[model samples]
Target: MFFEGFSLVTQDVQGVRYRFRSGGTAPDAIFLLHGRPETHVMWHRVGPLLARYYTVICPDLHPERSPEQQVNDLLTLATITGHDKFVIVGQDYGAHLGYLTAATAPDRVQALVLMEALPAATHEGRDDMAFSLAQYNSCWFAQLHPKPESHTIPVPAEWLEKPLPAESVFAPEAVADYLSASIWQHARTVTWAAACHPIRCPVLVLWAASGRIGGWYDPVRRWCDVTSAPTEGHAINGLHFLAEEAPGDVETAISLFLEHCIPE
Candidate 1:
């Protein structure tokens, strides 16, 4: 059975049971990673749209994995699919993985797309422009929970309504899958490697300009400032779920950027 237009599949790679979906006959490929509190199903709408032009793979990646481990998992998955190079797009927590994938193995990645997420820069858990209580609030919440890894973290319906409004329209199966997944196998707010490496590929940072992420620090500008590679950013109207709220904007941004990165 297909979840949306893609076939649901799982592969055991490097001792981890990785779940993902892949479809399309095109030789070119794109990988989609979801954010915390959600699964690969988060890319339901946007993934299929991109699938028309390129093979799209959406994976339920363990964000808790260290940058290096996550990158290894990604490469293994790519190898399983007979791809040495492919574009990757990530949103929110998924973008964290994207940064590492690009920085750690720049040669394997063709282009990088990040949306509503921060780079793997050093953050000391202080209340500075580099960090925010609200931005990292989920981690703070995890720390407060007595059993952060017990899969018992209660979903704050009222609190989440702001960022994920009723109109956001998440699928029931997607929400259930996200809630069932263990979100705390790794420690909360585990910073990236001691030294943040520069990404060598073309980068696109798409952000929601609705003022949710830029309260204290402009995250979009911050992303551009931290990256050493060729990078550009655009702001769109929506909540934190840019793919759900503004799929068209996401599509346009990625298509335009990939045009330059993968010029044919």
Candidate 2:
């Protein structure tokens, strides 16, 4: 009953099999991309909420493919799903992919919602002592020639840290879904990249108010440098996992941004 009205769909794109969840009946569509250590299940809470206003698509990204291929897969997924254009909502690593997708296909992406992410170039450009220390595991993972599944599959309990707001622990099913997917090569394949073309669609940057992103950089200003279109930024009341920790706040921010930026 988590994704009450949603249906699981499996399709082949460019010789690769892809699995995704599709739901809602609106003409407008939204593509939700999950981050590192998570599958489509990361959006379990927010997907259903956004489904009320738009057809929601949440896909499990392949770790072995390059970011370019992944972006193409997403665009092709949209085409096969009968959407000429759609809103992309991505968090962390997925946010990086979303940025590339918008840059790669501006006409097809109506708007972009980037959560807990900055441009790949921005991230590389600002790799400092603090970033290196905070993301040491990520840096190490990137360098590994053959990433180990044992290290990648399990959801580190530290990621879903304690002291969360009452009853906000991530669901067991969701955690299981994440573990089922192979994310061994995601860090190596997706994280570091060259600068992409400037984004033309409207952009909304959301980050955790208490997270390293807000503390490390000015998200709005950084995004302004990469996108030619108007950029708006907001800090949600949680840590890095905004969708899971603050779904209500995340949903509200996205709804408001879409209402103002993308006309129906």
Candidate 3:
């Protein structure tokens, strides 16, 4: 089993049943959120490693909830688990949710780890021909409001119309979970204005060195603009899926960041 000793749990919050995995014995907690086209399984590799030092919570994000509702779910999850202060680590769409969660409850979020995503303000403010052309597919996907369950129905490969990394890069079970539960809701981008309250907790931003993020903008600098607390950024050697392609690097970067921010 990928999760090994992790306990599989399902809890109801706000009339929604949330399925998640919990492991490790530490009092301090860390929540790992997955991006689009994936599930909590994306963190299979990194979660066990982090579990050695912290309680790790990996949850399958509900498909059709507003950003505020999603944040509420996470905050409530922490409360239910008896964690007043915890760290958040999110990727892609998950990064967006993490930002909202941190902003919604700054007192409870001790720190944040965001990968392969920029703050909404940074993205909107910097939108241009180059970015639009490069991210045309993503932009198109954002406009689509497909049925929440549309993702589960596999379409022809040609329908994707975009190149994806080889399947070998991901764990087989993880891929299976993604295929079964991935939803279009992940494509919906949350628009958080730059004028909104800045996140006060420390942040660690990680992006794919070979991906479009570095080529499109100064990720670290842009993140610094949105955070009032200390901000650090790193470029991992991989494409958009940092955790899947470079789990070791991801684990190392997060471990080092958490060590400095939440000392044992």
Per-residue lDDT of 1-264 in model 1, one digit per residue for the tens?
225578889899899898888988788889998876677887887887788888999988876666678789998999898788899999877887878787777888889898886654533343564344354444554465554455334553533443455554565555666667775455356565533577788888888777455444566566766677788877878767788778778887898889889857
Off by over 4 Å in 1: 1-3, 122-126, 129-168, 183-189, 194-196
TM-score for all predictions? 0.81, 0.87, 0.86
Which candidate gets the maximum TM-score versus the true structure? Answer: 2
Q: Rate residue 71 of model 1 by lDDT.
A: 82
Whole-model lDDT, candidate 3?
0.83
Please give the distance, in angstroms, between residue 253's alpha carbon in candidate 1 and its true position after superposition: 1.5
Model 2: colliding residue pairs: none
Candidate lDDT (C-alpha), each: 0.74, 0.83, 0.83
lDDT of 2 by residue, 100-207 (tens): 899899889999999998776766757776576576356446555665333442456544554433464577677666656676444454455644577888999999
Off by over 4 Å in 2: 135-154, 158-168, 185-188, 194-196
**TM-score of the candidate numbered 3?**
0.86
Number of colliding residue pairs in each model: 0, 0, 0
